[model samples]
Target chain A: MHSDTKAPLALKLSAIGGLIFLLAPIALIFLYAFTTEEKSYQFPPPGLTLKWIGVTMGRDDVWQALGLSLKVAAIATVLAMVLGTLTAAAVARSRFFGREAISLLVILPIALPGIITGISLRSAFALLDIPFSTWTIVLGHTTFCIVVVYNNAVARFRRTSGSLIDAAMDLGADGVQTFRLVILPNIGTALMAGGMLAFALSFDEVIVTTFTAGNQSTLPIWMLEELVRPRQRPVTNVVAMAVVLVTVLPILAAYYLTRDGAETAGSEK
Target chain B: MTSPAIFAPRSGVLARAADWAIRHPRMFVFLMVLPIVLWLGIVYIGALIALLMQSFFSIDEFSGVVQHEFTLKTYAELLRPSNFAIIARTVAMAAAVTLASAVLAFPMAYFAARYARGKWKALFYIGVMLPLWSSYLVKVYAWKLVLAKEGILTWIFAQLHLSWLLDAVLAIPVVGGNSLSVSYLGTFIVFVYIWLPYMIIPVQAALERVPAPLLEAASDLGATPKQSFRMVLLPLALPGIVAGSIFTFSLTLGDYIIPQIVGSGRLFIGQAVYTQQGTAGNIPLAAAFTVVPIVIMGVYLWGARKMGAFDAL
Candidate 1:
């Protein structure tokens, strides 16, 4: 109580410092994306323009990479959601002998170092003679993505109140009917949050994608290529900004959907 | 969450099917896990084994195909000081990031879980989480602008007349920074920034479970705010700190993108593995290198479980 008034001033300063640090790099890109001096990393460029955006739009490779990233992320998230939901439902709702082990197994992909997962997937693909392709990337992404969906679904399941399911059943609803009507509605926000987060994770994933992707480059892989090769710096910044927006927007949405009062109560479970 | 009764017993044909389904849950779960398990086994396990076996066998120096004969050459080669240095560097970087993130996260998590009211808490939580959505590559790339020769940080230093202080810090001998160069320090700063949120959220979740009344009771017993934190909060939050550290540690250790973009080409084991696999085309060695992180992680996870990380989450 004593510090409430005393705290606000310090807290305000800290919050402002936090905000600046959080935004500085992101904001810098906005300044650079318009810089007319293309060839170097000079501060306070003599001229500023939107010329780089136009240059970036003209690049076919950027578009192709963007398309591939979208496809891979979408497919991986969908796969993760379907499998994760079924697994979460089975494990969360039932009594099983090795449930703990299964639950741990479900979480391990995302939990273990991405390097371990990446190398494991790469070796396994090699054993199967599976070449690095879009499919391999999707498989790699789904392994981690499943963890996100499973976590959300399980949390939502825990919060739905078992009595509601019993109420539906006692009223003569069948298992499918109850699940379709009652269960889905209750966990919809969690599922959506999970899907959004999973998609964002998969979209930006580079380490695992590096191992799984052979020659085909996603936007991140392309950016990696450009970072190593200096001639494409401006285009890289453009694509980087695009990535900042795409990955950031969903994360913001996920936070709001998950942190809104409704979801905070769900989080308590 | 599920009633567990809806699927218990019923008289109709649908109930009969449900009963049959419940009885055959093993098969259903197996079916659900089959694709992923197969993928994990074939891809991950095979790579790991291939990597291990490759270390035991020699690579044909001329061809690099990994010869058929089993020998201890690669393992012996890996035992060298240079090779060991890479592992040490990686561990050091990871440790620095994890430690820094934990320190930075504590105050923020404390504020949110204990002090903030209503919407402000959610806003803080959201603030902590938003950076997570940004693509890892872009985030790493962003630091280039921060730490580069003429980047914004430099500009700010000039404006504040703090360039001399920065120059002195940068002049520290071991860090190899008489001036700001994109190296280990740059990598460390970004790693800490990027992984800080992972630590904060879990620590906040852990702190929330302390129960407000417990803190009130401690305060009533005449503990100062600082004393209350040490006595009541830290012990309650220890498990979460451990759990969150595992995430931060493992992520930092395995992050090839950040190191590749921000660190020097030969800076860490992540890069070593990438180069071995991609450039050197020594898949087995890359696989073998992956073992180091997996072993460390397995141990850390076991430790976390022993510390009751599950309940904390």
Candidate 2:
């Protein structure tokens, strides 16, 4: 009993330490955002100011880059969800030859290093004479985004009782009707969770985007450029905060959904 | 009903085509896989061929044109001591970050999988993944603030009366002063933090698959808690640890953005490729640079498969 008690306490302390490690960098950003320093190396800012926020909000370039990023992410997420759901359904529902091979192809983009994907996409675009554009960026993102949606949907499909579909069909329901009333209801949460994850992945994706995006800059790319140029640290912070909030909210929603599912699964077993 | 009334020959052609599609499901499968294959072949393979060819040929300085003379000039240049040093440094950095991410992520994964329940578990998992959702640029920017001399960390040190420790660490002769200011260390720290979620999620998924009954059985026997963990849990979770490490290692190795933003253009393979393509205008050399990493990664993947790390991911 004493040993068990000691172990949990030790684990908890280690967990808290991990949390601090995660938050320290974030907290540092928040602190610097309010600083009064001109350069970045000062130990302590002499004062604090809200000037950086205004500067960030006023910058047109930052807005342009952010808008481009949003546009790419939105388009990519929708495409991935649709294709991923279709592919998942086809694979999970119908037994077919070469199924594993097809699944492997779908998972490859995410499993392989992003650099390989980027280079591959870049070469294909060049071959098709598809000029580097926002479309190319979307293509690259959707490739990997599909993997997340597929994983979630497949898991949901596996857990869902096959009898429910059969019973609905037996009750004089047509294929579409059975799908609408039975299938959709069961997988609704899964799909929503998958979509959230896909969106999050698309939002943060940079490696492939860098290669596919010919000249246009995403918010991340813009921040990278600014880092090298060195005049826009505060504005960068503002945009960073915006990104943190946007990405985090949806992920929280997705987590709650998945957790509910996991608990039910645990209880069922 | 109209088939008979329609042209008999045309009907036969339609039937044959339908028969062909059904007969060769491989064809359908091939078509379905075509997009990605074409993507890989045309873009990936094509560019790689172009790059490989470029590496062999030398560039003419008289008119600044790439001349198609088959030679090992670029490889020779890349093999030089200074360039080799850069590769060595990058590998070391990548190895360190992978180790750091694994150590940091293991406990988090363990806690979420073994202890947390219901909504709290979900919330904690989401918190770990939330950083992944944010823009990569924003996160890197946040790190810059954290590590900057005038950043929050410095301020916190002063507030806590720990500035002496900070100064002492920063001022330690050859090991500290110049190196701390260079930003590579800051970049390494941020990379580990930013990629932590990726490492954690897969490991958690793997660890979660370990049956609770097995652990109980071990404990119920003569084995102590530590012994049970060491003997059973660690062996089962080994696949996940390996899977997560590959992500951390490869990501750190290939990433140009974090290093570019945080490492201040200190050359990494990714940055080297970007520079060769964009700044130096040496497309061939850049392509060669890109191939170096791919070859290395290919070898790594093969090794990973041999070790059975592929199963977990």
Candidate 3:
């Protein structure tokens, strides 16, 4: 593309401004984590200290919340992988009645407001007399996480060749063998990316967890409580910084993994 | 990989079961879809139906218990002046947020889609996504700090001799409060900040679909750059914009926490539902309030489908 066809200077500047708007608040969280002043958000901190980091680490509730979040994300990611991959295979490779409706059903959990999912599950649990526990949170997380993995896996599955399975079978391979040798390897990265995204989503999920988690506190819920009733402002900031790292790392890893191979093959079209 | 498959017993039960599944492909598909069906059907659809049922039921006013018999009494309550204000305010806020995000996101998406090179493209992806995937609650809280009375924004305005400018803006009528942190404006800003990336991704995707060659073809056929953008580019990006708007609009309509943390005492629909169920103990009315977003989004999505927005999404 020529300079004339490239993005105009004003447009480039506007994009930079947009990026700054998106990032500045997150950047402030990291900055304020080390602020010496505990009472407020200061322009330039009176002084910088590592005090909040130690304070946040010593808090038992923070650790417990973090542990619960990690546990829920792990379980939800595994469940989503199985459910999402199977559904994706069914939708992508087979001709089924109401396939489009099934696809729409998978997306609805995510596309709707989280509060609706939250309250609906809360009421359903009430009606069924199912106690709200870690499993309830897992159920809520899996409901939306399935969409992430299905979107990834179905795209990859469509791009994958059907003849590869036929060729494997022609070489005297059974269904298990064909899937093990052909399908898994082919869709593995996309599945991994999907799983990673699902994990990240579950890690930081708050609104649904608020309704489904009866007595449990995930990290985001913990942060919410702290913000509403702050013991020390910077402590939440430190936790927020850590939460950013935990969620962002997997998403970045997913991006890198997906951008290179068959994972993004369908999207490029 | 080959060794495990080769060493597996050919005539064994596992092999036979796999072979059986292969032979009955329809059954295989059914089995694959069965768990998803049960999960979604029992959990999602059943839950929705339950909510709808609760909405039709009325609450005993004095006893404060849900009377589960079918009635339109709760929905009639939704039309009450106070309850209707919550729905109207929430819808208005959601529409404003969606429009602001769309206006702000278009140029950025255009830049990323059109001219970003390898490293820049990677930066654009990670940059938008990092903020996107981070803890949403934390970002909203961070906005509280940024917009607080003695926060960095005020400090910046003071440094630039623009304190009165900030004051003048905050001195307005309905939306204003004591400060930005407690104003409706603050909630609106935080909402746009949080959901802005949802708008960006799809629009960038749509714009990326309009390849360079196509634009060049349009220009070569005697169209100016502006004309090419209007005639060639706008049509391609509209679906993506509409797609992003669905996310921004619906997410805003359903959010409760932002108003609690950052706004004035006005209630959004989500907060109304939350408090009705939790604090007010009015489950029936809460269910009725929940239906508002559901109906709005159902209609909005159906309309967008007609406009072919889901293709970009």
List, residue by residue over B1-313, the lDDT tens digit for candidate 2: 5446332332356555644554475564455445545553355556546656777876675775787888788777777786766677678888888888888887777777777665646556555655655566767776766677655667788899999988887676523443333456667778898888778877777888887778888988988989998999888888888888878788887877777766644688877777776777776676667667667778887888887887886
Give the candidate order by descending DockQ.
3, 1, 2
Best lDDT among the predictions, by candidate number: 3
Chain A accuracy of model 3 expressed as TM-score = 0.88
lDDT of 3 at B124: 84
CA lDDT, every prediction? 0.75, 0.71, 0.87
The sequence of per-residue lDDT tens digits that candidate 3 reaches over residues A115-208 is 8888888877887798989999999999999998999999999999999988999888888888898999999989987887788789878899
With candidate 3 superimposed using the best TM-score fit, by how many Å does residue B162's alpha carbon deviate from the native? Answer: 0.3
**Clashing pairs in model 3?**
none
How many clashing residue pairs are found in candidate 3?
Answer: 0
Worst 10 residues of 3 chain A by lDDT: A260-269
With candidate 1 superimposed using the best TM-score fit, by how many Å does residue B246's alpha carbon deviate from the native?
Answer: 1.7
Higher-scoring candidate on TM-score, 2 or 3? 3
Q: For candidate 2, give the docking quality class from DockQ.
A: acceptable
DockQ of the candidate models in sequence = 0.41, 0.31, 0.56
RMSD of 3: 4.4
**Which ten contiguous residues of candidate 2 chain B have the minimum total lDDT?**
B173-182
Error of 1 at B252 (Å): 1.4
